[model samples]
Target: MITFCRKSFIKNVFNGQIRCKSANSVSLSYNKITGCVTTSNDSLPPVLIFHGLFGTKNNWKSISKAISSKTGRTVYSLDLRNHGSSPHTSGTDSTLIGMANDIELFLDDNHYKTATLIGHSLGGRTVLQFAYLWPERVEKLIAVDISPLPTIPQQFFTKTTFIDELSKSIENISNDLNMSSARKQVDDRLKPLITDAFIRGFFLMSLHKNEESEKLFWKFNLNSIKHMLENEYINKIEIKIPFNGPSLLVHGQQSDYVKKDDYNAIRELMPNVQIVSIPETGHYLHIEKPNHFIDCVISFMKLS
Candidate 1:
């Protein structure tokens, strides 16, 4: 189980007084669902937003707020197991099926009879499985930059190697005088590979205080994350039920994650799926291009 600061933290972050405690809890039983945040307005159906590998609820904060304000809907963002403030436990497998189960528990406990699910990367895969398992509870589905099949191991290994190297570099730096120095350390390694400020910001969120001392450390459970990466990249999950609801599959033009070869499989599983490609962007399409992402989501939401 994971312990969180509950509604108090949320209140401080949003600067708004949330009136309901029916769904407020800082700490939760499943490590994956902790640090979850929810914002609700009077008129819209609940929207569930799931983050990618090593990502937290904070990753989607800006986008969630933007979408919530525009749609007048509640957006729930959760820190998947072993990430962010979520608990690191024996159940930290990080598989699609395991992650989808986390969503199931979250929705069931919160009295959300159904919701529109939007997920990215690993999250995108989780929602697909969730819809497959409980199609009746998902009104609409959106997958951003990932598909339902096994991902290439080379990509997973490359990302893992980058994070591993970055983590070691930060840990070895003893005398960090200021934020600028700390950032410089990170930029020295990452800037060459990722020039996008938003993507870099996403990686920086993992940097935090170590429990033992003032030395900064990554919040993500790296060992388990690395372990899960190998499994997820080379495995297939059985989906007994195909989600037969309205779905939008959005991929980045520069990304090879969601390829043309996977479209037939996606369509076979999700008969009503529509695919969209955003130009000049890659894996982190939502963050790289918010206006385009929001436009796509809004257009889909307007559908009956």
Candidate 2:
């Protein structure tokens, strides 16, 4: 059985039935609707995977299936709110805490007493926030290519500037044009800002056809995400307590997101964390080195 909350909660939010004074308001009660694709086999401890920014559950489909088959544990790849098929939210509800709350509701609605969380980039921060807020609910945690630091130091470019440029490029794609032309136009505009073909292609995945208008549009809630990124996601995480559960921090050798200097700080927060670095890979380690990524996850899960 697919255990998830009814889609009504999302509808209510979209209809303006739920309102809050601030983004930090705790009175908000409706479940933040999310989309997930799962591979199950009546497994005891399920693994929930969360994708990074501009990514959806589809990005992790093959990985989730492989993990499920090899480890004999159910694997779920979730589309965080405002991304993929998940419901979009605005204002305070788009913050990191809000995202964590959504995950909490997901677990509760599904009757999952505890789960092992695997998150990449933005999703990594979400799972970390979730574990911090509700340590008892997480059996384990795996953060990929992200640090628990207050701000993300620049690697490819300034994070804010990069996202803003990318957003503009996406917006520049003409809606009236055919998908192929729009893609070409988007690529042309993004070429100067983003030189890497792989990264540009990754961002392009968010583009989809609008059924009514027959136009290509972004599946993600770009405005909401931009707001969150500026106000919360890029800032330092405020955590009250550390998650003592078994934790794994995986980084790519070619990635600068997780720096050597940050290890002590990460250890201070997650004492049980074991750090692993995959060679010759960048921020998207899972995509660049799927076999190594899968092996690391499986090996970690098998540990007694």
- Candidate 2 colliding pairs, count: 2
* Position 13, candidate 1: lDDT: 14
Q: Local distance difference test, per candidate?
A: 0.70, 0.76
| Candidate 1 RMSD to the real structure | 9.0
lDDT of 1 by residue, 1-304 (tens): 3333223322211123222121222232321222223434544457888788768888787778677776767777777767787766442345655566677667756767688899998778778877886677788999999776655425532466765765665766654446567666766767766677666777787877554565766777777777676455324555776678999999898888887778898788788998999998889899779899989998998888
Top-scoring candidate (TM-score) = 2
- lDDT for each residue of candidate 2 in 203-292, tens digit (9 for 90 to 100): 778877787977667788777776775675545466888779999999998887897788999899999999999999989999999999
lDDT value for candidate 1?
Answer: 0.70
Please report how far candidate 1 places residue 28 from its true position, in Å: 6.7
Clashes of each: 2, 2
Q: After superposition, how far is residue 16 of candidate 1 from its true place, in Å?
A: 37
